[model samples]
Target chain A: MRAAYRPGPDAGVTVSDDGMSVYVARLPGGPLLVLDGAAALIWAEATTAPATGWVARVAELVGQPEDAITADVRAFVADLSARELLVPLGGDADPPTRA
Target chain B: MATQEATGAPSAGATVPLEVRIGFAHASVQWIADRCGADLLHVKGAALDPTLVPGRGYSDADVLARPAHVRRLLDELPRHGWELINTFVYGSSFEHSATLRHQDFGLLDLHRIYPGTGPTPERAFDTLWSQRTTKVLGGIDCPVPSHDAQAVVLLLHAARGGSDAKAANDVEWLWTSADDAARDRVLDWVGRLDAGLAFSVITGTLDEHRDDPAYDLWRVAARGGTRMEEWRARVRAARGLRAKLTVASRSVLVNVEHLTIVRGRPVSRAEIVAEFFGRPARGLREQVSRLARRSRR
Candidate 1:
């Protein structure tokens, strides 16, 4: 299984004024993805800490139940991976499930 | 950390960061202008308000000065090591502005009037100067156009350049960042400049109009001329046999300096001549077809 997920090499991230995470690609006139507060926290943590426990950590930080957010987190990660905003570690695998 | 190169020398292959070079250029130009008692208004590029669009990259610095002060600055700039590269005179107010080069600074475009094709350059300059705001750049007080004025200039520039991406981005930034009052002010300036057509196209306001006479005027404006005005310009451009020949020759030969800048290197005269004649022809056929279609209407 993959150890973690990380932002793509071309992804340039900046924090918006309202605490959203804005991700821009290296290419000129590329798409801009603005991640909301909850997703921003997840991305902030995922970029630094291991992705293994990010689900529980994000759930705790957002004051949501781990089960309540499990599907949404997985979906968000999958969508990001599909868009090359997030890349899985150790090649490819299913989106990480809550540890 | 980059030391300024010898005054008036060419950078050639220097590795100085662009932003650092721009800062140096702004400071150097400001210092020299102050010494000559010339007021300099920094426009475009790094002069953009960072709070609206941060981390924007700029290749050159553009500054506007009074027409009378331009000659004095031009004569004195070389003494301080700024090399005068070119002076292109398109018309009275439609000049190319001066292109200056320095070893420490990358490229500087000094204008006596705003370069965009819009309302009269003198009027634009007076309005912008009246509303100019001072911003400190590289420890030098630089005058910048107000947001409303900047928006109008950027829109006109984008329209003239066939809607370039960077120009569009800057205009969009200004549009989104402006408050209702600022937006209204920009619209008023656009109308005054006869750039309402360009503005409508840029902001997609044209889409809401249906067979409107105003829309027709905007379309004509977007093309940079109406049919009668274009014909008059052609007549003016070909006033005499020598002028006609000059225009004809220019159509086939690229200016060596222009070729050099476009190619990003020193180009030989022969290369320029070859590129001029060998360059792909423009869409003259398509243009004629469009003209014919318009005539039929």
Candidate 2:
């Protein structure tokens, strides 16, 4: 199922000052993950507000057509979801703001 | 494909900004504290009210737990990723906090007491907790002392900071440049916390409290003293004879926990024995040099 994503309830995330990297950790204990380049952009767009057409936004940001990036983006998001770092949005909820 | 690196335990240096790492550290500790049903107030460092000291930089997370809950929090911390790198006694002369490190989140100082506050730690925690507010760190709504109470805490920390420029800057922003009302608010908290003896360092009246047992402790802290002098002050400030003896005894013993941190590995028993004997001679040398410098001056 194609679903919008938000940072998982158990994840703690911080983005680099340049917006080029995203650091994510599972709560309490961790396998801290650093995502950069297209991955960082995907994580940022996927978890942003409106929770719709997020993958398309990532395609635009990276200067690629939606079709060209769709499969890869889905695969990346799926990877994160499996790790519980990012979760599919269940409803019309806004993404969280990082501190 | 966007590159992703899974850092099980990254090198000593981290690519993540320290503030960001510290924010996550606060969140992690807050998570552990909640599951254990313990209360903790994030303080100073990343927890400071941003308005009190503009652009203050902190290298670590600092949290003050209720005195009664400290032991439980200590026990539960290991269940999380926190490794106790330094025990409270070795953390500083005050013995107010223990230092722990996280593989991913860097360092956290779990303070049982915020030095300079409290006729008692229990009462001090209550005084700050009663007027608490919240700040979002790493997307977690962590409890912190009220803005005014933070101002007091910062000032107290600055009192013990000696000549550190950062401490001086904190004093400038929170106290020296503040208006009469802001000053009054800080003084009120100091009174409530029974922190007058220490806060006197900030007011330039430390001499007036010469009779107070803790006065020398504040004296050496606010005005850089030798290791020998610092240990003497700690012994004097200890409440009972047993505590005083404990503090005195600790002066000559090797702090193996501290040695581990300094060497970046656990010390051999022989290393510990060598340090145990070497420390007294080092203290004596430092004392002699200090006296010689004084005499020459």
Candidate 3:
């Protein structure tokens, strides 16, 4: 299934003063995902916006061509989804929308 | 100073982080303890080096006092704005009986024992007290356990808490900060606690990486036997049938204090029950699948 991505419902994120974003899973002893640079930007955007145009947005931010960045963004998002740091939007496991 | 004057009026201004407030509370508690002539030794979160856990936060100040002087602390601490909240009877190492709460300072867990339970030597508290030295932590001159003693307690705590990341980090800091002599001393104490095998296993793994090993030998050693050893110890520790029943009931019941501590609010009885049993089913499925995969290997 082609799944859209969003931040995991249980993810608690904290961005440090040094621009490192720490995404801790709400589950006890869950993985701590530390993102920096492009990865951090992708995570910030993914949490707030849909993942449909993530590649182009990230490419623009990182000064890379969309074609060059697409594969890396997909890989990163896939890894995060596998780790439960990113969840499939509009699925059975989809989180309730925030107000 | 009156209690209100000491704690000051509850301010609605910019709030300080809990960790920073805890630092000030440590100093305030020390000042009160010294005034009461009760020798105090800081332990656990409050005693950990800030350099090691940069953003580490604490919900309470853990202080160890001589068993003889506990009464004095109970009397004097209240005068300084620490109100007795509730007593806990869990078999925790480093905690005595009760907890105290202050408006500004948060919680204070008063202890009469060094390492609360497990396989610690009978005179562990006395030994730790004798070796206690003054260290300036967050500008508070407080007595802290000797490096060797602190290492033992930290390792045991980590093991008991199921080798959580924070605990592992604390142990790593202890290892890297200690000199060869201090390390040897810690190993000696681990030996006395009959935890040398566990200690070696944990340290060996930690040296290789920061990952908490799936199987922790330290936990086994802390129980003084295998996985079943802790239950047997608890049974033995219980004074009477009623005491044993109390322990058993506590294990089954949802501890509201635990919920409150974790959530930072007073959770209702129903919420506590829900929290206790609301283990994500996905986690269980994942664990089973992991075990199945391992077994297939």
What are the DockQ scores of the candidates, in order? Answer: 0.01, 0.52, 0.01
Q: Write the per-residue lDDT of candidate 3 for residues B37-79, one digit (tens) a residue.
A: 8777787676765554456656777877767778888887777
TM-score of chain B of 1: 0.68
Deviation of model 1 at B253, angstroms: 5.2
Cα lDDT tens digits for candidate 1, B100-147? 887656578898866442455566667678888987554357788886
- Per-model TM-score, in order, reads 0.54, 0.92, 0.50
Please tell me which predicted candidate would have the highest lDDT against the true structure.
Answer: 2
Q: Over 4 Å off in model 1, which ranges?
A: A1-99, B1-16, B89-95, B115-119, B176-179, B191-253, B263-269, B272-276, B279-297
In order, the interface RMSDs are 17.7, 2.0, 19.3
Error of model 2, residue B161, in angstroms: 1.1
**Candidate 2, clashing residue pairs?**
none
- Name the runs in model 2 displaced over 4 angstroms: A1-3, A90-99, B6-13
Q: Report the C-alpha lDDT of model 2 over B1-297, residue by residue, as the tens digit.
A: 643445543552356677878898999999889889889999999898788898999999999999999999999998887999999999998999999998778899999999988878999999999999999887677999999999989999999999999999999998899999999998999999999988889889999999999988899999988789999999999999999999999898899999998998989999999999898888889999999999999
Q: What overall lDDT goes with each candidate model? A: 0.61, 0.86, 0.57
TM-score of chain B of each: 0.68, 0.96, 0.62
Ranking by lDDT: 2, 1, 3
